[model samples]
Target: MPILEVTKITKQFGGLTANHNISMHVDEGSITAVIGPNGAGKTTFFNMITGVYQPTSGDIKLNGESLLKLKPDEVAKKGVSRTFQNIRLFGEMSVIENVLIGMHTHLKTNLFGIFLNLPATKKEEIEAEKEAYRLLKYFGLESLLNEKACNLSYGAQRKLEIARALATKPKLILLDEPAAGMNPKETKELTEIIKRMGEEFNVSILLIEHDMKLVMEISEHIIVLDHGEKIAEGNPKAIRTNPKVIEAYLGSAAIH
Candidate 1:
């Protein structure tokens, strides 16, 4: 079964309908991309999935359980985690600390146990640090584990955000515009990392990205959205030649 199933979901703000009867699914252990021009309600679609905005209509299910009425944290606990389009890292904290924070959702130590430094709590903390290190290493940020998040370069910071999200060990990870500001070299590196990410971490990936090269290279499946509606969905080969997708990005003039 697909890890995430969004069915006929719609979201509105007063008179504005940000998303209109959109439906899509992400299969387990696959890389999926959601692509569109700016203001295509891509972010709105993500918001609904992450519980930042409840849908006005329709249902969202993760592993067959409805996610309506759940908060973002609740959604995370349900095995869905995400990184933002804009980096939202704790600037002053060390890179490892930032990732450790993401593991908070599953960490079980209460304040009392932590304050006492009980054996079990200490063991859990050690395992968490090791796992965080493993994630940073995967992203090649392990050596800078003690560096402040704000001090990292833009590309590294993006990787850090993704590492943090993976710290949750979620079944699915949502990435919003992950390649937004990378140079060609950085984007290339990221493309390779993402291609291997699903299998490396044993998770499914659903991302929104404007970088067509990255999207086409890494996405096994692509969903194209235009004006908050799904216009086409297929593998890269089909989407690349899809006339409707062409019109959405270029114009009627280009298609002719």
Candidate 2:
């Protein structure tokens, strides 16, 4: 069975329909790219799936179980995690601390236990720190663990956001514009890292990226959306030649 499934999901904001009967599936341990022009509802669809907004109609499933009614935190607890298009990090916090915060969902410490310095709380905190360091090391950010988040370069900041998301130990991760601010070299590195995440960590990924070269290089499957609807779904080779996809990009004067 697919790891993630969206079945005829729709979302409306006021009278404007942001997503329209969208359906897709992401296989286990694969990278799936969602591409579209601006105002095509790609981000809106992502928001709905991740619980930033509830679907006005239809359902989403992870591992064949319904995720439609769950709140954002509940959805996250179910092993779904995501990084935003804009980097969202505590600027003043150390890189390691920012990652440790992501592990909060997995920590079992209560307020009383934390205040009393209970053994369980201490153990959990230690484990969280270890896990955060491991993630930073994986992303080549171990050397910057003590640096403030805002002090890192733009590319490093993006990687830090991804590291924080991975700290959650999610079975599936959704990345919105992971290569948005990256230079050519940085984008190339990100492509390799994404591939490694699937191959080594055994995690499935769903990404929305405007970088066609990066998407074509990394994605195992690709879905194209236009104006709140799916226009095409296939592998990179097929998507590139898809008339609908070409038309969608060219019509809107949006280059891939």
Candidate 3:
């Protein structure tokens, strides 16, 4: 069975339908790319899957269980985590601390226990720190662990955001525009990291990327969306040759 299944999912903002009866399956341990031009409802579809918005119709399932009715936190607890198109990090906090915050859902300490630094809380805190460092090291950010998040370069910041998402211990990760604002070198590095995340970490990935090079290089399967609907779904080679995809990129000089 597929790790995630989106069945006829639709979302409307007033009279504007952002997603229309979109259905797809994300396989286990694979990188699935959702590609499209701006305003193709890629982010909107991502929001629905991550529970930032509920679907107007249809169902989403993870391992055959419904996720349509779950709240965002509940969804995360069910082993789903996502990184935003825009980097969201605590700028003033140390990089390691920022990652540990992502572990809040798994932490057992309550307000009272945290205030007193109870032994149990201390132990959990230590464990969280260890896990955070491991993730940072995995992403080549171990050297920046003690530095403020804002002090890192743009590419490092992006890596930090991904590290935070991974800190949540998700089985499936949704990456929204992971290559946005990146230079060619950074984008290339990100492509490798994404592949490693699936292979080494054993997590499934669903990516929304505008960088066609990155998408084509990394994704095992590609799904193209245009104006709130799926226009193409296939392997990288097929998507590259798709006429609809060519049309979508026609006026977008940057895409070519």
Best by TM-score: 1
lDDT of 3 by residue, 132-230 (tens): 999999989999999999999999999999999988888899999988888999988888899889877779999999888888888889999999999
**TM-score of candidate 3 to 2 decimals:** 0.95
**Model 2 / residue 145 / CA error / Å:** 0.4
- Report the C-alpha displacement of residue 36, candidate 2, in angstroms: 0.5
Expressed as tens digits, the lDDT of each residue in 71-170 for candidate 1 is 9999999999999989999999999999999999999999999999999999999999999999999999999999999999999999999999999989
Each candidate's number of clashing pairs is 0, 0, 0
Work out the TM-score per prediction: 0.97, 0.95, 0.95
Candidate 1, clashing residue pairs? none
Residue-level lDDT of model 2, residues 39-91, one tens digit each, is: 89999988887888889999999999898878999999998999999999999
Instruction: For model 3, name the residue pairs that clash.
Output: none
Worst 10 residues of 2 by lDDT: 247-256
Candidate 1 lDDT: 0.93
| Candidate 3, run of 10 with poorest lDDT | 247-256
Cα RMSD (Å) per model?
2.0, 1.8, 1.7
